[model samples]
Target: MEDHQLSKSLQSIGKSCFVKNFELFSDAAISDLDAMQFLMDDQGYEQTGARTRVREGRRIIESGRAKDALKIIADARLEDSTLADKAYRLSL
Candidate 1:
């Protein structure tokens, strides 16, 4: 699905379902910044959603999901040039 359409569809169904479906359908991962945007903007999670993504991102990395975790960080930088430093720090 396209970004806007995905956002709209996520807004309609809610976060839990989105997360579940995301895990099931794709190996592609979500960046922390994108996660914040996805949760706060698309899922209506606000600031708490950003926090949730940070925690979840940390957990994913700590749990040895390194490949996926790195992809999350890399994606944020690759998708947005302005986020390079933040994404680098996030990966470290």
Candidate 2:
């Protein structure tokens, strides 16, 4: 499904389901997670959601799900252009 549609469909789902479905989203996964976080922050749930996201990202990395963890990092990099640029450089 398209990202927007996927987001709409995911509105009531749990975060684990949301992250698991990220695979179907491919490149748009980052944007979808951003929008989810934005909606949470807009409702004043920022810190909790951010903490969970960070913890989950770290868990995925430490568990050796490196490539999947890249989705989380890439999603997060939207908040840090320098990190995104550094990642791009590293990738090259």
Q: In model 2, what is the error at residue 31, expressed in angstroms? A: 28
Query: What's the lDDT of the predicted structure labeled candidate 1?
Result: 0.44
Please report the candidate that would top lDDT against the real structure.
Answer: 1
Q: Which ten residues in a row have the lowest lDDT in candidate 2?
A: 5-14
lDDT of 2 by residue, 1-69 (tens): 343533333333333433443343333335545645653655444656654544443343344443433
Which residue runs of candidate 1 sit more than 4 Å off their true CA positions?
Answer: 1-18, 21-29, 61-92
Clashing pairs in 2: none
Count clashing residue pairs per candidate.
0, 0
lDDT of 1 at 9: 37
